[model samples]
Target: MNNKRRVTVILAMAAIAPLTFTACAGGGAAPASGGDVKSLTVLDSYNNDPDKGILQASIDKCAAKVGVTIERTTVPGKDRMQTVLQRSSSKTLPDVLMLDNPEVKDVAATGALSPLSDYKVDMSAFAGNSLDAVTQDGQVYGLPLPADTLGLFYNADVLAAAGITPPKTWDELKAAAAKLTTGDQYGLAFSAAATYEGAWQFLPFMWTNGGDETKLDSPEVKGALQLYVDLVQSGSASKSVINWNQADVKDQFVAGKAAMMINGPWQIPALAKVPGVKWNTVQIPVNKPGQTPTAPLGGMVWTVPRTGDKAKQAKAAEFVACTGTEDSQMALGKARNTVPTQNGLHQKYVSEVPTMAAFTKQVEDARSRTGKLGKDWPKAATTIYTAVQLALTGGASVDEAFSKAAAG
Candidate 1:
């Protein structure tokens, strides 16, 4: 079974009582009853930001076009996870939900969202193994909407000031870091702290080394760890990167304190706003020759909550699938710089956001982080990352890092 199709089948969340279910139902399924049920709810993690405004508009447009009356709510993504857990425990799950991949796995373990495997739709139009990212226990739990990847976002002026070209390989990146470091200025800003941001940047390196994060004992993973250690211990990077309770790496990059960073497409608009800043983006480079450039995929997805009303759930699923189709995707393309997950929409978004095209293409060729890793990924990723950080920071040996982390 190609890793893309290795869906998780475990329904471990049965321990938490399934939440009360109801699909968008004041109206009938399919053709509908001319108008949508006036009182439907969607819970998402867009608590007041660009994602909030754009996503709410998208929801309103889709729901209105379908004649469905829908209400929306926003919560922090982390808090949304707790909401899913709480709702699963209290039986108050929302009718619709928005989540990213890791949260999808955590929520799936609780059996709260409806699986769309039975929903009729072709999967060939999507990118990366994004569809696979949301598959759990051999079932489709969510629909990946916009696909994205992490990349090196550099202030063109910063690199230009230092007279260095963009680093083409990890080794070049380190060398450039040394040359670029100056008073209050760093050549690189990465998410090395113990948080989601840390893993976001670190995972791509592990993938470039040809190691699934699920296999922490692999040599590739170890080599990736050593690279990170070399960066920090050798003064190529700052040790304060590990300081807790923040995601300010991008902030540093944007303010010109750092010359480059590993961030997703979401950072583009904000970075563009910084004056006198000429920035360009590129795919995260591999360690050396013969290895492909790697980028850990990231993106948002839509899903219907598992409900007692099977027919309504079915209706909602179809609508969700419709939102993923080529037409809706193209419509989305017309309005934003977002690349559509649909087959050809990539070309379209590339033209629209030309400067960011290379980064998007990297994601297209990038392999999905799946299989065993897809199932229990969050825990495994944290375990391996923490272990690697320990060794890189001089707390453990390379072998000891693997041995201690793999002891699980």
Candidate 2:
């Protein structure tokens, strides 16, 4: 699997704290006229095969359309922001930059990125939350590409043999999980590690239960935490969850130790390699019938940096726009196992890739983690995971977990 596509929330949030940059004042390359541009520099975190190649194809297609060669740089996801900061200070920022959506606001706040609006980039086809991911202070900072969200991945064979259907509500989930549990196998598996990955895994349950991140100690949030506690206490979920990451959870599922897991489409390639698994996905269940399952949107956004070259910036903007087009989105979505961020393409995308139907549906109501709290999102994420840890480990009761974690 490509590590770049699986960046944890902690690394992303940590990189933002020291990203102060002076947009156009850096002393490196002189401004070049629009006519002088013949090639554009691009930087992104798709540094492995498959994803690297998949993204390159899209970049190449866009490069051809814009009539310019692309000078690209691929970094590991965790190093992406640091690279940007280093390049920005040295006035060598790439003309086109790809940012993990959650990091967009912090980077934009530093004046390191050019507003796509200034180039008249058409963003009408994108999802509202996708746009919100890159929007800061009324200005659109970047264009989002294909996105992903959490889903309930089940071993079809296990569920069928157990006479179970995919769960749709909290009560159903608990019942199904308990019924599926057997000797040395957990009915449900999810990450509860003390990291942003854990917080992300918890979001669907929290948000669907009407829990707000800003008010962590509220009844709604406690209800969500209690669900986690109940599962572990009942042995429906393993106590090891508090130590496992998403990748670990997937491994457990693949080994048949877990019947279902909370994960994303990025795992599709890995799952495909294990033909014996026979897995399928569904939207994460809501707390009740009327509530919506709101998972956090996961993907990167392309931006034009203030590289002090009008021609290169214009060409880069064109390339960025090209990548977000319906055709480009469809191509990337199919090759990358991601859902297109463009509106009106979900059904069409689903028609083409049936396995992605559930995820596509989830993206419709999914939100950006930074949408509500922006830079402060990391703090909330930390609180969430801490509460989960406390409750699951018996350090605190469900009713006191969030409040205690918040207080600390």
Candidate 3:
């Protein structure tokens, strides 16, 4: 369930009247001397995402345990919430806000987020790249709730009928794809249109080949892109995938229109539930023999905004601290098919969504986005997709497209 929000700064109840902002750090980062314990405002884009809902629920759960209630305000998407928060620099930019993995550094660059590392929370305990994505300039900036990795999805029945095993090495994958191309089914599927899905879908290829969007001209880049071109030119890939968007590809993959796809941990639950269908996940085919598995990291974090409401900031900080635990976080993995940033999420997730365990295994070796973090990361991804789309149109060579893209 992506339905989550980062609940922040409650402003009601406590031993006080109405509530006035109080500021200051307590010993070992406790709530300030004077604070409001009654109401808090959380800014989040999860209202539509639903996947981020765990954050809001956790805050509410923890608040009850500690005796506090939260008033959450959800934004439609990243742009809307970031716009509001940016404009409200002088005003309190909602007590807490949602921060995606790639945007952690950018948001911190604005000097808006309060450092959780300086507070009561111990940063290292978080799972995966939580600390890397949120830490900026050697300071912790935000707290990521869900952490995920990218990989390939397959229709188990389809693979079984074809008498094929999941490919373990990159070379084997190509041969398998060649073998699996029995009919309308393609050995693999990926989006090529200039968009998020198209761009994100290409990352695994990039990573496996030792290339990334940032270094699109590397030889590995050429080899990786060649695979996509082969998938299309050989009529083993779907053209609609290029521009139809992410949801389209997922629906198609789930409906059995395609045999395999590259995706993130977020889709694990829904994919597992495909009725009368057998589906399984596996890491992207490896590039080098005996090398560790690889994938692109995905997910978001929670951050607090400072507006002179020291009490509100302190409350938001504590609420964030509540959800950053390994137990609570991995427990979430069971519920959402998401991976926690902490290490202990293994047993928790294995018990709930076993199919996802392979996906989570990549966390220790997965790579985050190479481009600098920013609220605009999605925009950059879009730009890269544009290059993919243009190349897929058969208008230019993959090298030309990426070369042009790199310069662009």
For model 2, which pairs clash? none
Best by TM-score: 2
In candidate 1, what are the lDDT values of residues 1-408, reduced to their tens digit? 655444332343443334323332344443233233554567888786666777766777777765666777788877877777787775666667888765676677677787877666456667636766777877778877676678888888878877888987988889888888888887777776665566667778888878776567788888888887777777766776765222477688767777877777766667767776788888887887888877766667788887565655666676677678776765554444456765567777777668758766776765555535655666776676677567767778876786785564
Q: Candidate 1, after superposition: displacement of residue 201 in Å? A: 1.6
The worst-scoring run of ten residues by lDDT in candidate 2 lies at 17-26
How far off is residue 357 in model 1, in Å?
0.7
Q: Which stretches of candidate 2 lie over 4 Å from their true place?
A: 1-34
lDDT of each: 0.71, 0.91, 0.69
- The clash numbers for all candidates, in the given order, read 9, 0, 23
Q: Higher-TM-score candidate among 1 and 2?
A: 2
By lDDT: ranked, best first: 2, 1, 3
Which segments of candidate 3 are over 4 A away from where they belong? 1-34, 48-56, 78-90, 212-214, 370-383
Error of 3 at 146 (Å): 2.3
lDDT (tens digit, per residue) of candidate 2 on 1-408: 467755765677667745655454556546555676788888999999889999999999999998999899999998998999999897889999999999999999999999998899988888898988899999999998899899999999999999999999999999999999999889999999999999999998998899888888889889999899999999999999999999999999999999999999999998999999999999999887899889989998999999887778888898998998889999999999899998799889999999999999898889889998988998999999999999999999998888888887
Compared with the true structure, model 1 gives a TM-score of 0.85
True-structure RMSD for candidate 2: 11.5
**Maximum-lDDT candidate:** 2
